[model samples]
Target chain A: EADIYQTPRYLVIGTGKKITLECSQTMGHDKMYWYQQDPGMELHLIHYSYGVNSTEKGDLSSESTVSRIRTEHFPLTLESARPSHTSQYLCASSPPGGANYGYTFGSGTRLTVV
Target chain B: AQTVTQSQPEMSVQEAETVTLSCTYDTSENNYYLFWYKQPPSRQMILVIRQEAYKQQNATENRFSVNFQKAAKSFSLKISDSQLGDTAMYFCAFMPLNNNDMRFGAGTRLTVKP
Candidate 1:
């Protein structure tokens, strides 16, 4: 099983509410990524972090923001949630190199803006 | 920019049989990584296998294997001895060595019938 963990497996909240999805990993990987995926749809890269204090926006336009204060934690926050932001948020982490292992993914957080 | 494509949106295979999922990607970099991720009904993105762009040999992980054709810009996943546990949505992804963004395909939903 993957070492990455995502909290609040599912969430349903009113529009315009502030929500944060938590992702943590124990593998001590330097790279972490957050992706948004709709049901049976493509995954859009929203945010990613290479190391502590380093965060970058992905190819997809997103209203959410992320922080990487620690090596194991990368959390995503949405200032004002909307129906369009409702989707499954996945977190993944991978080692720098050497091992050449594939990415380890979290269980994912399913958010619903109701 | 890199783009991954999975032409088949849905596929089905009988138990104990074999199934192949096709994936193609576009990238300008010569050195990069390709990956196949599986998302079951639970919504978790699980890494099935990975292949390095520079490697001519394909990658295999137990029952899951990939056909990597660099010249054709094609990477396909073949699952031998399909099982019910294999029923899930599979996504193909690409990551260039110069960056950390792992572009993913729309995914192919596979169902294994008993």
Candidate 2:
């Protein structure tokens, strides 16, 4: 199993509440990504970070924000959650050198906004 | 912008039989990487196989193999001797060589019936 871990495997909250999903990797990868997926559907890239202090929005627009203050930690937060944001959030990390290998993913956090 | 497509939203195969999943991608860059990731019921996204765009030979790992038709912009996966354990959501993804962002196709849910 990969060293990557995501806390709160499942979450349910009110629509207006602020929420944070935690993602950390012991692999010390330089690149980390967050993807949003509906049940049994394709995944959409929401956010990503190349390294500390370097973050970018993905092809899909998202109200959520992410911070990469540490090489192993990339946490995503929503200032105000909504029902439309309900989805499975996946975290993945990969090493440097563009090898295209070593992409380790976490189990993902399933969020539901009521 | 790079985009990946998996036309098959779902597939089924008898135990011990073989199955193939289709994936196509669009990109202007000549060098990139393709990957197939499996997400099981547990929700952990696992990397199954990967192929480099420049390589002429398709990538294979045990029972998983890829048909990389670069000119056709098609990358399909063939699973040999299917097993019930292989039942999961399979995703096709692409990553450009110089970019850190990876794009994923809508997944194909594979069901192996015994």
> TM-score, chain B only, every model?
0.97, 0.98
**For model 1, how does the per-residue alpha-carbon lDDT over B1-114 read when each residue is reduced to its tens digit?**
678889999999999999999999998889988989888889667778989888899999999999999989999999999999999999998888766667889999999999
Model 1 chain B scores worst on lDDT over the 10 consecutive residues at B95-104
Model 2 captures what fraction of native contacts? Answer: 0.69
Model 1 chain A: ten consecutive residues of lowest lDDT:
A94-103
- Pairs of residues at least 3 apart in sequence or in different chains that clash in candidate 2: none
Q: Model 2, B52: alpha-carbon shift in Å?
A: 0.9
lDDT of 2 by residue, B1-96 (tens): 889999999999999999999999999999999999998887688999999999999999999999999999999999999999999999999989
Top TM-score hit: 2
Comparing to the true complex, what docking class would candidate 1 get? medium
- Give per-model TM-scores: 0.94, 0.95
Q: Pick by lDDT: which candidate is best? A: 2
Report backbone clashes per prediction. Answer: 0, 0
